[model samples]
Target: MKSTMANLWHLVKGVQIRDLGEKRYLFKFFHIIDMERVINGAPWTFNNHLLILHKLKGGEDPL
Candidate 1:
């Protein structure tokens, strides 16, 4: 498996934050110049879903 630093480097080189909204944030990642346009376009919504799933799975809160 790749180390965390390698993964982070890839992520950083490929991804960018586009916007932050009240309920969500937007992001984009580049893979191919014209063929692919990856758009997260809603970070907060994803985070909320993850939190809900974690709670349902009985994961301990880090707070």
Candidate 2:
């Protein structure tokens, strides 16, 4: 996950990945705009797993 985040670090100003238990994760991005790009142009696969992204109304907190 760290490597994948590093690869996309430029496009994204900030992010925090929290394991919400199970295999689910919560990705908090600094800008929802950048998050939109990731959602639209995503499923960023590295290795064999797809980097699934989802959008919600709110989930922003500066970590």
Candidate 3:
């Protein structure tokens, strides 16, 4: 009864989410503050496990 990643435009203007393959989604935000907010202020939760968000450096891919 709800939409996920449906109102991306409402969240960030001119932002685009691209599929980088391997079940990974890349989001480009225009503002560095937005990225910092996501990395430091965003809240993630799971049913039984803690959600870990990693910052991938340039030319780095998680295998």
Candidate 4:
């Protein structure tokens, strides 16, 4: 899943997706612009399953 998403985004600075259990993932991008681009592109998918993207502010809980 990580490799798939990484390739899909083709981010300049790159990104890392950490499995957060129960199918949730934390996508960490090296650059702000890369992050913004992914967010703006929204509604991503994998294996026909919709991949939801969310931005968590500082101190915000992902769960």
Candidate maximizing TM-score: 4
Q: Rank the candidates by TM-score, best first.
A: 4, 2, 3, 1
lDDT per residue, candidate 2, 1-58, as tens digits? 7557757655556677787776777777788677777787766875777776656655
What residue pairs are clashing in model 3? none
Residue range 1-63, candidate 3, lDDT tens digits? 002332422344334556667655666666666566656754644344443556668888644
What is candidate 1's lDDT per residue for 1-63, written digit by digit as tens?
Answer: 123322433443455443334533333344433112222321222323531111112364323
- Report model 3's TM-score to 2 decimal places: 0.48
TM-scores, one per candidate: 0.29, 0.68, 0.48, 0.90
C-alpha local distance difference test of each model = 0.31, 0.69, 0.51, 0.89
What lDDT would candidate 3 get against the real structure?
A: 0.51
User: Candidate 2 or 3, higher TM-score?
Assistant: 2
- Candidate 4: which pairs clash? none
lDDT of 2 at 4: 75
Lowest-sum lDDT 10-residue window in model 2:
54-63
RMSD for each of the candidates: 13.5, 4.2, 4.9, 0.9
Clashes of each: 0, 0, 0, 0
Q: Which residue pairs in model 1 clash with each other? A: none
Runs in model 4 lying further than 4 Å from the true structure: none
State how far residue 4 of model 2 sits from its true place (Å): 2.4
